[model samples]
Target: MTLQSDQKEFRSWLGTCRFSKPADNGETVFGSQAVPTECKAVVAIWADSEEQYLNVLSLRMERYGYGIIQVDDIMPAPAWMVLKARNRTGPVLARQVSAEFPFALDLIENNPISQDDNVGDDKTLKVIVTTTLHRVEPLDAQFGVFPRKTLPEALTEWFFGPATPNIFANRADTGNTDDNPSRLYAVLDAGKIPNLGELLSSSGLEYQCLFNGKTASELAEVAPYLVKLEDNNSFTRQLFSRGKEPWFLWDRAGGIFIRTAATLTELRKHLRKFTRINRGKNDWVYFRFWDGPVLNALLRGMKSKPSHVATFTQCPKTLTFITIDPLTDTANRFIIDQKRLAGAKKQPVTPAALIDTVQLETETQVSTEKRLIIEAHREALFTAPGPDDASMELLKNEIPFLKTCGISKTQYLHDVLVFLIRNDLTGGKLSPEQRDILMHKRNNAPTKIRQLEKTVSA
Candidate 1:
């Protein structure tokens, strides 16, 4: 199994990252699909932005523990990923990929990335910075001192415009190509935008909240808003035009966008059909299609079942979905051409009345895929940082023992492991209280482990 982490966001990737001397920009990692756990593991450090982050970082690591790291790989993050996962993945990734810098420890602190220099980069888009270190020999020979590549111009232009291109750019109809179909609009989660409802109210742009009618009055602040943008519109221009007003869209990506020619009311009705789905429980469940990756899966589900596509999509022309996975700094534009799909367009089904048994079954299958994607990202969100190769080894051995204690939740389990690694809990003798706290049935696992996580984090 291969491990990758951007800062402390630990995850399991399906291949190896081999580090030799500085090669083609960031395309350094290589080898077979499966990595041998026993082979000497290599660590690569990166700085994702076109700023001082990398320079400041590598200088810091240069002074640590015999100063074994060399800073030479200044290639693009996409190239790095291509070489690393080339076995299983192809060149589906576009111009956007991240690179980050070397790390330091005041025993290695929080946010882990430096945010001190926020002058002109206030609205600069961010990509997660991943680094790894192992107990490999001749570490200095493997790494060399070089610059890291900046985020690609084409990808940056997608969110930001050509003259004013960015991830934080608020301008609509900026990046459309000849292949793009239908009108585009984004359903934004209000939580990410400061005073989102207020902004929408003041702006002349057409918008409708996810929770409309009665729910709109009560849960407006919490609801996601579907916004339709017009080119050069004053309200849209103001979103990212403020000097250095942090590139908010690329920062959190709190929602997803849709491409359809249907009017807002009709489009909303088409989507409302799937919002309330009946799983095995026989009760209606709210499916959050507007939030990031699930919409991608929802579109995929609609594509496979042409009947649902016909029944739901209001526009007979085409329906293309664009979702940006902030986690990977990747944006996927999933298209469903209605003209190509089989079956006649069915009448719009109200949220409550769309509950046919066969449709419900199909919806359940779609929900399952959505759930799996959500779980995988959730699992990858919180993992303990590997300080050394030995920590990783101990971590693997410690998991089975911890499972016996009922710590199965991903974050909780990792919390316990992080505590163990940091405190050398297993290497040294455990206090009776500590041992009891871990294994005791009366105290309950979550409560006990939560306290331990606090200490580890502290």
Candidate 2:
């Protein structure tokens, strides 16, 4: 809001606050506050490590009232994408994500572009992020994702040391488990985590976005993350301790905790493949295997519930998946199937990335199309939306009928299946013309469904 419009929210208090002259000991005071760092934002920052980055985040929020929303360390921005981005003029942050990133940076800074600046060749590149900041909000909307007030004064804050990741994780770390034999990682659903981007910025915890290489810029802000806890760092301790309030790491969004000997890099590459799967011919859909019951059923029901050790650990056989029930300390364990570890997708999980919305088919007396139909809505069938949506038996019954109706599209068959479950209708109800419309790809299936729904409602 500009002063010309006389916006009351932003009063003209330019001359109201001024910095006082430095004292004999060089203690600078501002107005009646007698301090300057209390409510301030940092301009220059040091973000070499994840821990240092956390401090940088707090300074940005406490001073500026805006918190970081999305920080992604792994976004597969190739050379071409980077070159294309360099041509643009605004908001294209030439991050340390790719080798070609430096060229773009040089162009932006108007510096002489050089090959010598092309650094960051390690396993993972430097972190670049995206965020949505808010000016101010009610305390309720701002819970669990804001920087805490510095106690006493800024003098005491610096005189001592920096704070822990969050209020819950700051205290005694009774949850530290560095000695645990199994290296643990978690797949957290970003969709369920509350204001995940803001939480990451202020808390200063490190995480990896699971959607790598495939998507445009990896869609880092909304992918399931891979949170490796073997380091036994403060982030790990914080997550374990956060079981009570804010429910940070130990959230139950159908994601699983992994126990694998594979190095973070190896496991990431291996797991990344399973994010999307062969839904149909060239059509691919996200495979959310991290969802608890879905994974539970997928592994157990699969005929081959075996662990591919060489593919997983590069040595001995050691790979197991665990699922935790929300609000409880107990957890269930299982060995995932080897068959479906061949796909990947977007937007998921908490600390550790979750992906591979996967399924397993049993040696049942069913046709190929029926299995495909079942696999298409695997998560929903396992956990139906409501009581009326419970149509496993009805769906099973209608699969063959749907096949006979020549309704090849999974979505159309699914709609017809639901209609059969809800209404007292048979294969006879669907008009031949409607079936023809649904069966043909060029025809609009939704319009036919709308007509059917209208007819039923009438």
Clashes in predicted model 1: 24
Off by over 4 Å in 2: 1-184, 189-204, 210-216, 228-254, 259-310, 313-318, 323-332, 335-391, 403-418, 426-443, 454-458
Q: Which stretches of candidate 1 lie over 4 Å from their true place?
A: 1-182, 191-194, 230-249, 278-282, 314-317, 342-437, 444-458
* Separate clash counts for every candidate: 24, 32
C-alpha local distance difference test of each model: 0.44, 0.39
Q: What is the lDDT of residue 70 in candidate 1?
A: 17
lDDT of 2 by residue, 323-363 (tens): 54332233444432121222212222221223122333332
After superposing all C-alphas onto the true structure, candidate 1 shows an RMSD in angstroms of 18.6
Question: After best superposition, candidate 2 residue 422: deviation in angstroms?
Answer: 3.3
Position 233, candidate 1: lDDT: 52
